[model samples]
Target: MRLSGKRASQLALNAFIVLLLAMSIYPMTILLFGFTKDSLTWQYNQWLPALPMWFTNLNYAWKQVGTAFWNTLFVAAAATLGGVFLSSLGGFVFSRMKFYAKEIIFYFIIALMMVPAILGLIPWYLLIKELGLLNSLWALVFTSVFGAPIFGIFLLRGFFSSIPEELFEAAKIDGCGNFKLYYKIAVPVSLSSLATLAIMQVMGVWNDLVGPSIVLTSPDKFVITLALRNFSMSMSGGGMLTNYPALFAAYVISSIPLVLLFFFASKYYIEGLTSSGMKL
Candidate 1:
């Protein structure tokens, strides 16, 4: 009787897990159905797939978001590379090197993370405007790179400091210099952490709507999020009528790159997150 009860409870738990997973993915599944069907089919039946995949929806969305897609890709990629490089370098400096007021400076950098980002929006905007970077992609790239390194530094610092001193001592014994030790030894071992930082930076830049909306006024300079917002507004006839299929298709298209990024880097990304003690 105990074994049977155990088996029943195990089955119940499995069912609950499946239920939760379905609930989680239900919205995306509906989005897929919406994007796959034509306007008439969607209007008639809001759920379930229909025959003849509507490629035109994607084509129209592509035409609308194509420029912004490339712009976002460039900005995300640039920010990822720049953030990883700077954060890793900063991590190495704090971890392996001894310098004057190092503890104080490191603590100061970490303290900045406690402050709310929204509080700096106005000042950041004025600074960008003063630099004549308004409506420029460079503005986004520069700010993403420079403004978001605190957490990365903290993460990488802990990882770098955990490295065995014997390795650095051996490298020094072999006449390896500081820069070589950094690029050759410290970085190679911390690729997972660096990958984590890159993934985070890219994701932040990719999904950000408000920052781009604030900095970029030109349609051509707009990122994917901004372009999608405009496209959705236009397709909806100023909120009177809406094209569900095309708008959903645009959302799906906007999501593909991030999905691909994770699909490829998921191994490294997972490792980085686990090692850094981060949840989700």
Candidate 2:
């Protein structure tokens, strides 16, 4: 039987997609199995972990935890909310309002993105020290929360720019004040951009290791990555305190929220990226 050209193309594309997916998921699969598999006993030839595995590593992680989880949750959530709100509001203003030197100011800020993030570390540390925010979650939140990165603002600006100008005029005519226009009209319709912004900010703030490591000295003040680094490697296994499986288990556990968040927000995330009027 001769296969149609379209069917053959579809089959090839499906195979390509599946292969790409497997490539992407390979690292995560190893970490997932680390939760159940023993690090001590391993066969190199075996791609998958051995059977008869137990949940000992996961149980240990759950019961032997400290403040890393809660601290990460709070910081990530606060930064995400504040960063998203501020960026969206800024986007609305830049897209809808006419002002002097608007493009000049916007381009100036956008140019800051070209500057390497490493260049700001010194200044950020100095600023944090001056404000007495050292050893505090506020240092991390402050970096992301109220003042957002240029890319985030840039992304939301494109989305807001795509919205019809007539909507804003109608809202104003109906007695909608500036804040109300933004909060009630702009925000409600921009859920896609908002979700993308929130997800990005949350992931960035949560997974941040360098900032927290530099600003924070106290063990209890450590976020998830730093805390996991210090604690997970110390778990008992493999005839020593350091257990590879336990560390991977901790990584797996810590990543749950982010995975779920992306799963739920992926629709809106894709929508935001694909929306029209994404020009500068």
Candidate 3:
């Protein structure tokens, strides 16, 4: 069908957006293809490199990837659980309860958020060392848990505020105590925000490299990101070929969990943001 001038302009604009999207995604696509390929040489010759066509690369990468994957999983899970629980509790208190020095305490938490992470690294390291958590997954988990309070508290407070006070009053009238009201009413209503914050915390803890790099000195304790760095370092040689295919394979494997989590949580994630802003 022929298009009018305005229709043609809109089509052209959409085509441009599609082109940009493809360009942005091409590198990742190529890297994924490289992961399946038998040899890195194929990358130089074709846009669509010949993959292993068999599954050997994936199997090989998985052998070492499992340990790192688990390490990351443990840290991320612990951190997200701790962060969501503590932040949600704190948010509820700040939003619902009026008490002495509340504003002062809240401002202190906000100020803590403003401090650069690097500035606290040294003291954190010392504390972890003194506690004998250095070089252990607990170090990573604890560090993330402590670091998460700022944004977690902030996001959850907004969510708690968005909840109607009438709900709490109604619950109280129905003989619900403070704990029961928080657990049964507020928490159920704030599920979306909690899920969103959980997603963010999981992603952050899973992908963090710097903190783990300093604390986890043991190779056995390496997370996926650290393992990827180690793989890259080992592949780089003076005037020699890198094992691009293997490294790419590792990269692809490492991203699967994160990609799957986001896809599964996308609906709740959107709902969370919208609900956090909804008044009453």
Please report the candidate that would top lDDT against the real structure. Answer: 1
User: Global lDDT for candidate 3?
Assistant: 0.82
> Ten consecutive residues with minimal summed lDDT in candidate 3?
45-54
Error of 3 at 202 (Å): 1.0
Residue-pair clashes per candidate:
0, 0, 2
lDDT of 2 at 62: 55
Candidate 3 residues 155-252, lDDT tens each? 78877887899999988999988778778987899887888988988989877888888888987899998988887787788234666667778888
Candidate 3, residue 44: how far the Cα is off, in Å: 5.8
The lDDT of each candidate is 0.89, 0.80, 0.82
- Give the per-residue lDDT of model 1 (tens digit) for 127-158: 99999999999999998898657998999999
Q: Arrange candidates by lDDT, highest first: which order?
A: 1, 3, 2
TM-score of each: 0.94, 0.86, 0.90
* Candidate no. 1 TM-score: 0.94
Residue 240's C-alpha lDDT in candidate 1? 29
The candidate scoring highest on TM-score is 1
